[model samples]
Target: MMKLSLGPILWFWDKCTVFDFYARAAEWPIDTVYLGETVCSRRRELKPDDWFALARDLKSCGKKVVLSSLTLIESEADLRGLRRICEQDDFLVEVNDQSALQLVTAREIPFVTGPAMNTYNAATLKVLAGKGLQGWCLPVELSRHTLARLIQELEAEGLDLPAEVFSWGFLPLAWSSRCFTARHYNLPKDNCEFRCLQHPDGLSLRSRESQELFRLNGTSTLSGSRYDLLRQLPAMADMGVSTVRLSPELQGMEAVVQRFDTARRGKVPAFDPLALTEAPPCNGYWYGEPGMDRVARTNAD
Candidate 1:
């Protein structure tokens, strides 16, 4: 059976809210849960010790927990934090950047590569696998065809690494040193007052015509439209995908998990356009088309 895993919370929430969210998530159908602050290091609602405690609680509930490292490591503090995460022995760590990977490899720890890592080809996968990469979350920009071909190439090389796909949620497009959310409030990045907490889903960036283009979440930019691959579960299963990742949102996440749970159980979920919040659904990247295009799903493809 294909497993469902919840990605780390990308938005900044109150410490209590974060714990409450995970407390509820413990009972969900998810097989795995990723915990950590993957965005800005400053969004420290839950500290490293707090995250470890949460991971222990989730593991007690029978959910495999993975700690994710920061996507961008800018300062010595960030590297120190990454080292701490890499040094942990209780849970598998998701390496989001090359620095994190280096730290994990140096410790000879088996790690999972997050989507932000530049793992485009089989050669890269093979290299990482040699260094104890247990699983990989496919980069968001890659298409289904690309994934299928890469799997074939890996097979030919006698390399087998579990592939995990980002099945749902807003695609994290990029990260920057400048915080757009802070800029919106006319504050500097150093002393931005953690304004991202105001918009739980990150501040929406729309065009002059009011077309939603992107979401400004601290130092990260995400797709305006939520990426939904509910209809592609069957295809993913056929491709031998070990896990399907569902990025956490502020609301309706339980319903989203239930829907995905149903779909993976051999039921074709009714495609409700409003199942996700904010902008419309998009799966074009799966079909090698524009990221925003909502291409109809067909088995023929």
Candidate 2:
């Protein structure tokens, strides 16, 4: 069976809700759980110590916990946090930036490269693997044909790092120093008072025709259409993707997991996973099509 991984929480929830969510997730049948702040560092609902504690607790519950770092590094303070996470020995670290790759290299630590890291070719994969990269999250924009080539190239070189795909969730396409959520509320980035915590998922962006286009988080912009790959589980497994990642959201996540789990096991889910979300569903990047195109599953029965 293909493994399931819970990606890091991208939204800023209250401290209590964050804790309670993970407490429940620890009992899920997932193989790996990624924890930490992968977005703006100022969304400090959970401190480093708190994340480490949660990582430890999840590890105790028989789940593998991987610590994630920030996607954008604008300040020395963010660098300090990256250093702290890379230096830790208790859990594995997922390097989200080039600077993080440097730190992990210096420490001689094996790390997973987060999707935010730009890795598109076999040469880049080989370079990262040389620097202690044990696994990598495929860049969200790359198509399956490109990935097939890279995997084949790696296999030709006898390289054995695992390939994990971002199977479901809104695609986080870009990040910036300026917080869009703060700007949306007519607030300055510094004095914004953590306004992003107000939206559990993210503030949605609509087109001129009032159709949903994208979602605005603190510094990141995501696709309005949720990425759904339950129907593609067989193809992903055939591609030798060892793990499938589910990015955390506010609602119906347990059912989401169950749906993917059932689908991966060749059982039809009670509900259509694609229709469960308010936004339109997409699996284009997986098939090398436009990122927003909905490709119906030919194998779905």
Candidate 3:
């Protein structure tokens, strides 16, 4: 059966809200839950100890927990945090950057590569697998054709690491040193007053004509439309996708998980794309088309 895992919360939420969200998640149908801050290091509503405690609690509830490292390591403090995450023996670590990968490999720890790590070709996957890569999240921009070829290449090389796909949620595009959210508020990145908390979902950046183009989440820029692959579950299964990840959102996450859970069970649940998200759905990247195009799923695709 294909597993469903919840990605780490990308947007900043209050400490209580984060706790409550995970507390509810413990009872959901999700088989795995990723914990910790994967974006900006300054969004510290929950400290290291707090995240560890949460991970422990989730594990006790029978959900596999993985601690994710920061994507952009700019300072010594960020490297220190990455080291601490890699040092954990109780949970798997999701390496989001090369620095984190080095730290984990130095310790000879098996780690999963996050989507931001850019495992585009089989060669890269083989190299990481040689470094104790247990699994890898496919980069968001790669198409189904590319993934199929990579899978074939991996099989030919006798490599058998599980492939996890970011099947849902806003696609995180890029990260920067300058916080677009802070700039929107006319504040410096150093003391931005945690303004991201105000918009549970990152502030949306729309075109002058009012078309949603992108989302500004701290230092990360995300696709404006939520990437929906609910209809492609069967295709994913046939492609040997071991797990499908659903990025956390501020609202209706339980329903989203339930819908995916149903689809994974070989049942095609009714899914209205627009109702599930603030913006329309997009699966063009899966079909090797424009990232924003909505392509219907078919066996041919």
Candidate 4:
């Protein structure tokens, strides 16, 4: 059976909610859990020690734990935090930035690259695979065809890193040094009161036609439509995808996990996973189309 893993939380939530989510996550039918702050370092709801404690707790519950680093490292302080995560010996570290990758490689530590790290071509994957790369999550923007080719190339080289796909949740499209949320509130990034706590699922962005376009959260911009791959489980399995990642959201995550778990076990979920998302569902990038376009699953695409 394909493994089910939870991606690190992309949105800022209160400490209580963070702890509570993990409490419930321990009992979910999840094989792996990623813990850490992958976005703005300022959203420090959980300290490094706190994340390690959580990782250990989850590990104790028989769940594989991975510590994720920030997507965009902007300062020495952020680098320090990334070093701390990479230097640790407990859990596998998910490298989101090149800095994190360099740190791990320098230490000869085994690591996995997150979606944000953009491990697209076979050449990059091959190099990383030789340099202590345990696994990699396909970039969210890559299509299924591209992934299939990458996997074939890896097999040709006898490389054996597990391939993980971002199978659910809103796609994090871009990251910036400036916090868009703070800018929306007309506050500077420094003095910007932590307004991310107010928008749990992220403050939505819409076009002039009132079409949901993107979500502005801290320094990251995400797809307004939730990127769901519930119906693509069988296809992924056929393509030899070893793991499927479900990004954490502020609400309805347990239901999301349940549906994915059921599908991974060869059972069709009774309800549509799209119905659980706050925004319209999309799987465009996965289908080799525009990021917002939805393509119904068929044999080829």
- What lDDT score belongs to each candidate, Candidate 1 first? 0.91, 0.88, 0.91, 0.91
C-alpha displacement of 18 in model 2, angstroms? Answer: 0.7
Candidate 4 TM-score versus the reference: 0.98
| Per-candidate count of clashing residue pairs (backbone under 3 Å) | 0, 0, 0, 0
Q: State the weakest 10-residue window (summed lDDT) of model 2.
A: 268-277
Q: Candidate 4 on 1-301: residue-level lDDT in tens? A: 9999999999999899999999999999999999999989998778999999999899999999999999999999999999999888989999999899899999999999999987879999998988999999999999999999999899899999899999899898899999999999999999889999999989999999999999998999999998988888888898889999999986788888988998888886656834654688899998899989888778773
The C-alpha stretches of model 1 lying farther than 4 A from their native spots are 273-276
Per-residue CA lDDT of model 1 for 194-282, tens digit only, reads 89989998898899999888999999999998899998999988988889999999898999999899989999657654455668788
Model 2 segments beyond 4 Å from truth? Answer: 268-277, 298-301
Return the TM-score for candidate 2, rounded to 2 decimals: 0.96
What is the Å distance of residue 217 in model 3 from its true position?
0.5
Clashing pairs in 3: none
What are the models' TM-scores?
0.98, 0.96, 0.97, 0.98
| Residue 185 shift from truth in candidate 4, angstroms | 0.5
- How do the residues 104-197 of candidate 3 rate in per-residue lDDT, one tens digit apiece? 8999999999999989999999999999999999999999888888888998999998888998999999999999999999999999999999
Q: Write down the RMSD of all candidates, one decimal each.
A: 1.0, 1.7, 1.1, 1.1
Residue 195 alpha-carbon offset, candidate 4, angstroms: 0.4
lDDT of 2: 0.88
The residue-level lDDT of candidate 2 at 254 comes to 84
